[model samples]
Target chain A: MDIPSHITIKEVGPRDGLQNEKVILSTKEKIAWINRLSQTGLSYIEVTSFVPAKWIPALADALEVASTIERKKGVTYAALVPNIYGLERALQANIDEINVFVSSSETHNKRNVNKSISDTLDVIKEVADQSLFTGRKVRGYVSTIFGCPYEGKINLDKIKKIIDSLLNMGIYEISLGDTIGIANPLQVEHTLEELKKSFPLSIFAMHFHNTYGRGLANILVSLQQGITTYDSSFGGLGGCPYAAGASGNVATNDLVNMLHTMHVQTGIDERALTLARRIIDDKLGKRFSSHLLQIKNEQVKK
Target chain B: MDIPSHITIKEVGPRDGLQNEKVILSTKEKIAWINRLSQTGLSYIEVTSFVPAKWIPALADALEVASTIERKKGVTYAALVPNIYGLERALQANIDEINVFVSSSETHNKRNVNKSISDTLDVIKEVADQSLFTGRKVRGYVSTIFGCPYEGKINLDKIKKIIDSLLNMGIYEISLGDTIGIANPLQVEHTLEELKKSFPLSIFAMHFHNTYGRGLANILVSLQQGITTYDSSFGGLGGCPYAAGASGNVATNDLVNMLHTMHVQTGIDERALTLARRIIDDKLGKRFSSHLLQIKNEQVKK
Candidate 1:
């Protein structure tokens, strides 16, 4: 019942979404999709990740995408920067915001980035400091905060420590990731309650996956807990590469629709979001996982 | 969070689920699926609808299925009875409970049952009386409580009047249905708050569809308002017959999985529900709308 009147939706379809996909979009296609996303009234868009081509070939055109997207005024264009080299590339591309991520679980952290949690933090510290020095705001992503596929339930203490480190390194916000999409509403409430005791809730964002159809439910609890910022993908694109059964991030269209229906202002144009989804759908030639997309498809059939 | 520690799930997959499908299951297959559902610890199952064969050929074998399923001792096998004639057949099938449904919107009621709201309630009144006189408890379903495809936003006063009429007719519990899957959490919270002012929350259940993927989110708000009973279908099976682009009911597997994860007991086995879904999947040869099914498919591929 205690929901925010307005919320911020950070579109992550281009980076987090396309990274896990098999089909590689041309640099021009990626730029076109981001341009479409920019017109959707989303204030923030993560356009691409600067990870190496060997790590995520689908997003290997990260520099091209980051540099070529038509950056709309008042919109923050972000790119994921894994280390100093990635940060250099993102900086060269003039990304508006730099996002660095590390997994909360040791096993998942090692498997994802070939580094321990501590080592990942060390790299993130350098990236955050460098980005801050360059007058660019940096956001931190703490993955597997809810549950890790290999290690199962993550420790809250570990998540707290990682968040603390990120905040100490001049990171402006920390996005908590449910990498395996195993979080329930109660778990989200408890975690947020604990985190709120340590830091202001405004400094945190919820990044959920809709694997078991609990993404919106989790978001509902987060809203009740005063979380206003959420990270979602267009048409529910992307899945965890390391977690076998993990699904994509929660769909941006579904999130915006729910928010608007509930009278929670998201400032998003649902019609425009669909247009962005169409761009990706055309390039990938695959069906998406979003319920809104299914409804649209049904309407088209009729 | 004020969430209930224990909840009741009324399984509607066999009746509401199959009735909307293009592929009609044989009576034997329906009975087998119901028997499998009985093993999953569901205390209530709406097995079939006793409508005229001309109206719903998919459920033409209703009496055969209702009578032949291997009913577990603690489970209440129920059936949908539209009129006195349907009630007679349901009584003959020895169903434990009778469910009567009417749409809150006038146009949907006319389109679905070819009768005015008043006339449909008149029929429901007679059906309820006969079923109660026969010593069978009757439940009521009020569809399109959230929004109607034909009428758009439904009037709460109209819904309240319909619910009052049904309760006056000896209907024990009323299941509030989002027939078009248009309800959001705030709407759910507001509606339940208003309804609780007139009736005890104990006498109401929430029935939601996943058309826009807001089902679980809506359920979260309902739970916060002390709604402990829900109607769900295995594998998200059914869609509204008259509502264009409506998706299936909120999946029982996803519902039970979330409840169990949140430590809210429904006494339902997730694995057993999956087994029951397999039966329907084999019979229909189609993928379901439930996220749990998608996750299972992903796991199987791995």
Candidate 2:
């Protein structure tokens, strides 16, 4: 297969990974991990979320994480904003970028953020408008774009509509999250094929969870679709707050491993990513979801 | 995507998954597991291998396991053969079908079976002739159809040629094996697009390992291509002799869970597979690799 020559992975572990983790990371460790990822030449690093402490208290230190991280010159550090209030908080933190999620599956949308699809979109639109007024770039996320645990297979027509609305609202790049992690490569193939009909590949990114263990496969499928931007968690840490039993997002190390093997250049260093995963897994006192982190072999380069 | 109405899984745990495991099972447990799989309604089961004990001493109990298992009416039992001599042993064991493997990569063939590509072809031809003389159906296996751990990426043209040879040798069907579990769904898509030009969907099946955690994803891609029959290990058992630190084949339990979720009909029973995996994992003193077995929520439908 003629895969792409290079890909961009926006590491989101500091925010997405920690938000759902059971053992709350000391704000210091979270900052340390994000700082570690910064030195690896990553262009974008999601720092934290601005949700209230009552919701996802694991990231209650969001403001602390955002302000304490060591941001490199070219890196764009972003954070998840739940609404206009969260967006205002993000603006106060002076973050590089902002992200808002509206799940494609209505059931997940309600359960995830306690808002109906339309209601969620309204909040997102208002927040996007406000962000635009402030000259801050806002990225839109459409989670469970392909399949959902509660709803089964998703309607991609609905997915496209959400993408269209988000794009029309002047949001930045949209990431299609396989939230429940049930989608396979075929789903990815068809989803990208349909999305390509309306939007440019540069406007789209992929977020996959490793629930059924298809994260890397889905990422590879996305790569074949000419998608350069990806969402990965360091040490493969991160699971959806709503989807139980789902593993972490695609491990940063694993994604890099597969990319380097396919002769694709991912500007990030594989060794540094591995070390980041090691720190997280050791701190958590549990194994990280990444298989690459578990096996430290020099043979990874070949 | 219009997923297939049904998918056929050719359970290969007894032969493929168990063979490479360091722990050896006695004839009684082997017979028990093989017989248990029969009740699960798997149509095709690779129950044993006929290689020399010196080569695969773990399966030296092949004869006893093959002889003692109570046969089910609709299930077709099979064995893997290395050469004509292995085929003779399978014939003596009354194996309903025999499978032989050849590599698309010349280097893999040489390293795997210690024979050149042409020499391996000659050997397969001899075995096929013997199977024809004995009125037994010979199923061929094209191993490393994806990238090989030893040789890296394989040429689709060479693979089509090897498959053509197997077809011309009077083999009934050829199962394409991803020996290294590095293939993504697109690689599967890319290869199937080429192989289908020469081989019909009915004449081809897939043998996948879950090493890089894409077994189910790759299966979804294959199912979309109309390939029904698949090879899986119980509890995701099995490891490649070539890929160091790679995990087991896609767990039979995990495969069934996914297929059942997709509203596809497979005769296999998920609960029984889970029970069998528990037995295997308990005996081995470690967590088994199957994703379904790891799920604690246990929505295991009968």
Candidate 3:
């Protein structure tokens, strides 16, 4: 099957990958990494999240990083915003796009931002309103779409309602997130089949973790159902702080490699991404959760 | 999907899993594990291969193990027979089923079994005929179905020819083996689509490895396509000897867990399989390659 000509790689390395790192980078370091990723040809890079510094100390410098990071031509630097406060702060930072996240699992949403599913959606409405007023792009994320750690099977009706509400409020795109990576291909297909029947393929993207080792496979199923955009972290960075026993996001380089071999152009160079991974690994002083990073690192050593 | 009533968990742990272990198990230990696995409710157990003793000393006791091991009720104990000679030896041990494997990659075929693809098929024809004459079932394995470590991408036509040849020679089931474990859902779908054109879904089985972490995803894709029979090793114990970079097979307990959650029946007990893994790990002095195994091991310690 001929997949779409272009697939968008929304880089979550700066925000998602960095937030999970024990050694939090300075705002300047995060900005530099974002700029470097821009040069490496990523169209979208999520700079940081505007959550409480007390909750996510790594992104304590989110505002500074968002404001200061140089926006390259054609690069869409996005940031995660929890509510109207985070949204207003993001708007002030002049990001190209803004991301608002809620959980598909009720338990996850309750644990994540200390709000119920309804409460979180109520707040995100304000963010949507703010986006509409300012003419800024608002993207919605439904995390824990597959299996939730606390509640094993997530209600797909809830996922659909959240997506419908987000789409109804005029969100540009919605990402279906498998928060803990417990998703297999069938789950991905089963969820996507139901979602595709309702949502247009253009408005739906996928976010997957490799915790249970089905990240790329899940991506493939989504792609088959005509999904062309995805959110991934470089070196498999980023995890859910609220979800128990979650690992990093699906690796950007690994997805790039698979898509490239399938002749699906992802725009970002695999070699360049691998090089960036090497630089990141050296800076981090340990291995990332990515196989592509390790493979690239060994090739560099040789 | 009303998948096969019993998702036959072919415990390849004995042959497929142990062949890659750093330390070779004595005949007694390997036999003991196989025996214990038999008691744990696996329907199909690939005990060992009847290949050369010098080549695979890890399973040099293939004949003895097959002949002597306590054959449990409902367990179809099989052996890997490379050629007519190996099949003769398997016959000597009175294996219930005989499995013959061929790679879709010509390059891998030459390097792996020291024969060209066509030559390998010619040899298996003799084995298939002998097995058929004796009323012993013959299972065909067209391995590297997803991608090959040595040769890289494998073509669907190559896979088709191998499977068609095996079917023509009276093989009962054809297993599509992802030897390298690099298959994504899209590729698996594409391959299955092509295979289904020639063969009915009922006689097809899936064998997956988790090397690049796509094992379960591929299986899910297969399951959606109405595939019922799956071959998984206990504790995810198998690695490829010919395909060096491939990871262990999809864990039996993990497979059963995912299937059970999806409301599919495998007729296998995940808890008993978990316990069997403990027995294997205690004897082997190493952790098994399973998410449940690692998690349960820690839980037991606590």
Candidate 4:
């Protein structure tokens, strides 16, 4: 199996992770965490989401958080935008990239955004076009690409159509998410084998959840398929609010540790990433899930 | 990657898991756990270790645990035997198999058993000869085959020598262990690729720790290399007492989940395995570190 010499890791801790948590970090705390993440040699950081405050109080301070953090020289600071209103807010905050999300499963799409798949696609098409006109890169996220909590196995043809539509609308990158963390290696191989046939590897990334401990194994399969970009949360901070038993995104430290150990260079400062995880974990008054952080905690006890 | 159609899972929770815990279960508790494990369709279960009570107070009732459990028709009840004395005790308990372990790294060997590698080899040879005559299957475990806690990376030559010694002793299976949980897929591939040239696939198994969260990934690499049998603990119990933050063996549920999801038949009932995990977790008054168990807990909360 061929493995890449280098891979790209996008940190989504501030957005995806904190949104699912009960405790809310203050605007200052959010900026501090994002600022810390910027120094970790990561190319992209999904700083926050621009959804309505009433809908998600956890990320209500997204505007202030987006404007305050001192942007790093080489890092791209991005934000999740739900619709034209959220995209407008993100544009006001000067987000480097606008990320639009939709789920392949109809049940998940209706529950997550209260819209049908076609409506969500229309929004994505409109947002991507607007973002491109505003001189910003647009990233598309297809959630529940592997399996859905309500609908079970997602149709591969549906996912392919979504990807084709997103790519045609000037979306620069597309991240396929296993929202409920039900992906297996063979399932990943099957999905990618078919997906790669219609698209090049350059526009694709993987965002896996570690709810069932299949995150790294799925990543291994994807790496062999030559997809290099991965989206992760520091400290493994997010869980699906809709899916019971679904845990956080794969931890950035754990992902980097495996990548570096396998000689797949990620250019991340391991120490800096841990410090970033610690800052948010301490504020949340809990130790978030992370294999590297857990080991570090043990070392401290020793 | 060539994935196996079937894999062997040897449950080591009853022995290796409880041995490293702070709380010792009562003899009755141990018996109950083992009995529950037997109904889980597992073909092999390491019920207890035959070391003296002073060495492992947690499993002091190994003899009682061994004598009481109702063995399933096809299950092989095994125990960890330290030497001739431990093997003799195991023989008295009518263990279906006897397992002997030694570390590949000299520093780990000296710390773990207070014996030199050559001294340990002599004991294994003598014990294997005795066990063969008694008509019990002999399994050899080579710990720290990938990396060591004391010595960073173990020498491949040293591991080859250990395998040769174990094979010469008439041991039927040699389980390569990642004692410190520091194994990466590339490291596993590197070691297994070299080891496979000399040994047939039938004689090798993998014992990985989830300490750094690379357990499943390492297992994936090994499966691709055509190694089938795996050693795992229920609820991912059994941490490295010497190595800080070293979690227990990979959880049997997580292993089965990945294997079954990949269409690799392991003949294990998923619900039965979780029931086994619950019995131990409730008795210990703490949840162990299996990703699958943790998710199940979340589901129960909901």
Candidate 5:
């Protein structure tokens, strides 16, 4: 029952959401969407990923997207950078923050980045060093933190080691991802309790997918555990390519609606977020995984 | 988190689910589906409603459905009975339990039953008297306990009064319903805290809609408040006819999945439940509001 008065919501629709979508929006479209999100009072947005186009063709225009969007005064525009090469592109785009990712599961990390966990960390170390030297903050993402598609249950000791490495590398915050959306509230409470024993709870962020519809419940337990920051996509737009049967990230619209209803402020306007969702819905021409968006669609039809 | 080790799940798919669905299953289909559910280890199943066919044509075969379904040992087959007339029909069908419903919001009650709250309660009192005289247990449903469509925020005092009246009328347990699916965890905690002051928490059940995707989160908070019983539908069927934008009831599949993962036993078999869902899906031939079913569908497509 002890909930925070305010929460930090990191908008990841432009980057993670678009990357997994089948339809690739044009550079102009991406910029317009991000610009719309900027005006919604969101203080942080992961705009694009600087991965090679060959890896993620959907976000191929990352540099253009990061460079052209209208940046709000307090909003930190971040882009995911895999290594020094991607970091160079992000720096050239004048990104406000840098993000690096590695999977806690070995098989998932290899499938995601075509490298071992240690190798991925070695590369991230260089990226983090350069991004810090350039006066840009860095955030880390640990995917498959809850469970892995290939590996059933992950070893908590391995997750602790990966988090330790990311924190030591100057990554201010680590977003723990339920890549396949298989986390439950009991597991969330137990995991957070263990993680808090080693690190400050503030450095942890929850990135849940609504695949099995337990995302909000897990987030509720996270709130009770005193973790505040959350990463979500507008219209519930992202999924893990490596994980079959996985749905999209927890929709920002649904997350914000629940948070605001609980009197926990996210500083995001619901109507403005709906405007941004409309753009994505128009381009996709499909139903989203978001409950709020689906309900609104039903209302419009009526 | 003080979660209970065992919980009771009341499956209301056959009655509430089909009542809101556009497709109407034949008596044979309903019997077959309910038979499948009886095999799923679920102890309580609201098989059908005895209201007039003119009102809910989708479940017009309530008499045959309640009579024909295979009654497994340890299963309580229940049906909704609005008044003495419906109670007579349910009694003729030999239903194990009777359920009566009234909305907390006067407008919703008028719209739903063409009667005021007090008049509806009077009708329920008569039905409860008849059912109890016949050696049958009766359960009460208080709709729009969280919020109402026409009345906006319903007064909590009105809800407490309705619950008080139902309990006084020999209703064994009262199910508090979020008719519009607009409830949040904080609101759930606050409301449950207030209700517990006047009644034992064991006498209350949580019936939530997944309209805003806050169903499971609300259930989580209810668990923390020591409320053990929940009402859900297979494949997430049922929406409020009076609420314009409300979605279906929380999917029993999703609810059981989370409960089983949390080690809270529900005495239900997941695979057996999927068999029941398959029958509904085939008869309806449309997508359901269940997260687990949707993910399974994607896997089938793959």
Candidate 6:
């Protein structure tokens, strides 16, 4: 199978990861971690989410984190914005890139955002247009594209419509998320095959979860499908708390390790990434999931 | 990439999984677990090892386990034998299949078995001859085929030589083991491409560890190479105790889940395998390393 020569990794640890974690990091702690992550040579770092404090108190200081971090020269410090208000907050904070998400499955869209798919699309259209018009890159996330907890087996037609809407709204890239980690390689291949025919490969990214231990396998197939951008979290942190069996996003460490070994350049510094992982994982007072990180740390102790 | 329509999984949990574990299951516990596994529809199960008690105190009751479990009609109960003495014990217990192992790297071979590769080969030649003459199948395992703890990269020439020697000595099949789990897809593809030039794919199996979290990805590539047989431990148990950072073997649960999703049949019952996993993992008083098994169990609890 043909694979990409190099891949871009968008690290979502600070935002997607911390939001699901029960242990809340203070503004200072989040800034420290994001700054450390910036030095890891990651091109994109999703710093925080600009959601309302009551909804996600964990990232209540998103504006502070966006303003505090000493952003690196080549890194794009990004933030998640749920609506026009969130996008306005991100703009004030001078976020490098703005991310907006909607679920492809109608049931998930209603459950997650309290809106219908069409309603969510309208909000995304406003958010995407404003972000792009303000000279900021807009990345769209289509959650539950593979399967849904509330509604299993998402249809391909839904994915295509969502992608077309996001692209027409000027979203620079769309991340197809396996929200519940219910995807298998065959399902992933089939989905990508259909999606690729409908969209340019340059505007696609894969966001997978390790909920079923199929994260890397899915990524491997995505690589063969000529996908060059992937969304991941450091130490594999971030999973929906409501999703009973779901784990974190595919660990950034594991993804980079596999890519490097396969001769696919990711331009990530392993040592710096581990240091950032240690800082956050230690602060959380728990071992975050990431097999490569865990094993390497264990060896160091030995 | 064409995948095989069906695959054979040789469950190595009882022997390899328990051997490396710190917790010791009593003879009765082992028998109970083995009996549960027999009903899982696995065509082959490596029950226990007949090595010296000092070498593996965990499997000291290998003879009793081999004799006690009510072996199912379709499953072949297998055992690991380190030398002629272990082979004799296996013979007395009427083990259906015998497994012998050596390392592709000389340092690892010496460290693992305290014998040179040539000397190990001589012993394996004897064991294979006797087992075949007695109408039993012999499976040879070439450990550290991809990477070694003491020696990082192993030569492909060494792998070819070992396979040739085993085949000539009447070994029915040879398993290429990534003992330290340092395999990548490109390297696996390259190694398999070179080896297949001299050997038939029918006599080969892939045994991978999840040390680097690349187990399933490696397995995916191997499946595409037409390898139908794989060795895995349930709950992802079994790692080299001597290798400092080695994790468990690829979990049988994860392997079957991936294979079945890819439309490849393994003829194993997921529910039954999970039942067997619960029995052994609860007895060990720790969650074993299979991500899929752990997540499912956690969901059931919720």
Docking class of 6: medium
Per-residue accuracy of model 3 over B167-242 as CA lDDT, tens digit each = 9999989888888677776677787788778778788888887765557767877876778788887777765554
Which regions of candidate 4 fall more than 4 Å away from where they truly are?
A243-245
The per-model lDDT (C-alpha) reads: 0.88, 0.79, 0.78, 0.87, 0.89, 0.86
Clashing pairs in 6: none
- Candidate 2 has an fnat equal to 0.25
lDDT of 6 by residue, B200-254 (tens): 8889999998877888989988888899999999888876665554568998999
Ten-residue region with minimum lDDT total, candidate 1 chain A:
A278-287
Candidate with more favorable, higher lDDT: 3 or 4: 4
- Tens digit of per-residue lDDT, candidate 4, span A1-302: 58888999999988999888877888888888888888888889999999999889999999999998999999999999999999989998999999999999999999989999999999888888899999999999999998998999998888989888898898889999999888999999888998878889878999999888879999999998999899998877887676555558998889999998888999898888877765666675354678788777667667
How are the candidates ranked when ordered by lDDT, highest leading?
Answer: 5, 1, 4, 6, 2, 3
Tens-place lDDT per residue, model 5, B1-302, is: 79889999999989988899877888988898899999999999999999999999888888888988888999999999988899988999999999999999999899889999999999999999988998999999999998998998888888999999999999999999998888899999999999989999999999999988889999999999999999998888876565554558999999999999999999999988876766767766354778788767667678
Per-residue accuracy of model 4 over B157-253 as CA lDDT, tens digit each: 8789899989988899999888878889988888888887888878999999888888999999999998889999988888877666666898898
- Per-residue lDDT tens digits for candidate 3, residues A67-165, read 998889998888999988888788889877889999878887898988999999999998888887888889998888887878878887878899899
lDDT of 6 by residue, A1-302 (tens): 58989999999989888888877888988888888988988999999999899889998888888988997999998899999999989989999999999999898889788999899989988898888888888999999888888888888987898889888888889999998887888888888888778777889999998876779989998998899999999888876665654568999999999898888999998888877766666675344678877776666688
Kindly list the per-residue Cα lDDT of model 2 for residues B77-177, writing each as its tens digit. 98989898888778878888878888888888887789988899899999999988888899998888888877888888888888888899999888888
Worst 10 residues of 4 chain B by lDDT: B278-287
The residue pairs that clash in candidate 5, if any, are none
Candidate 2 accuracy as lDDT: 0.79
- Interface RMSD list for the candidates: 2.1, 4.4, 4.1, 1.8, 2.0, 2.1
The per-prediction tally of clashing pairs is 0, 2, 2, 2, 0, 0
How many backbone collisions does model 2 have?
A: 2
The TM-score obtained by model 5 is: 0.97
Task: Show pairs that collide, candidate 4.
Answer: A238-A248, B238-B248
Better of 3 and 6 by DockQ: 6
